[model samples]
Target: MDNPQRNDNPWFMALYIGGAGGILATYILIGFFAARWLVGMVEGPRYWIAIGTISGLVLGSFHIVMLIKKMMGEQDG
Candidate 1:
């Protein structure tokens, strides 16, 4: 009997990467715009720094969720 090949489907990997990349890109653009607006109105370097840090945290959390979901899907498959 032949053994089944695991990880044979590249499409699955591509789909996962593309979807996550798209969302991350969108989040980054939105974060940049929001930060720009905030900095324009807030009038301080501290506020700019805070906005960047917050955006990084948000993006990082989103990436973590995506990673968990991908892992779960792979396990289920």
Candidate 2:
């Protein structure tokens, strides 16, 4: 009998972790630049900081969800 939960390949795990880390790093960089740009706007830096942070979190979560879905689908196949 084959075990569904066991993944013998280490490369997949490494790639997944690397991709997730890259996504997180990208979000952080985007937030940093957005905040910097928004700081010069009339509304002030606080609003832009909040907006950037929230957007980053939302985007990161979405990426994670999509990755999980893709992984599950691949496993099922």
Q: Report the Cα lDDT for residue 56, model 2.
A: 83
lDDT by residue for model 1 (1-77), tens? 23344344789778866877777767767776677777778775656756775796688568858785655555542
Query: Which candidate number would show the highest TM-score if scored against the true structure?
Result: 2
Which one is best on lDDT? 2
Tell me the spans in candidate 1 whose CA falls farther than 4 Å from its real position. 1-9, 46-50, 53-64, 67-77
Give RMSD to native, each candidate: 5.3, 4.2
Give lDDT tens digits, candidate 2, residues 15-34: 88799888977886788678
| Each prediction's TM-score versus the true structure | 0.54, 0.66
Per-model clash counts, in order, read 0, 0
**Candidate 2 backbone clash number:** 0
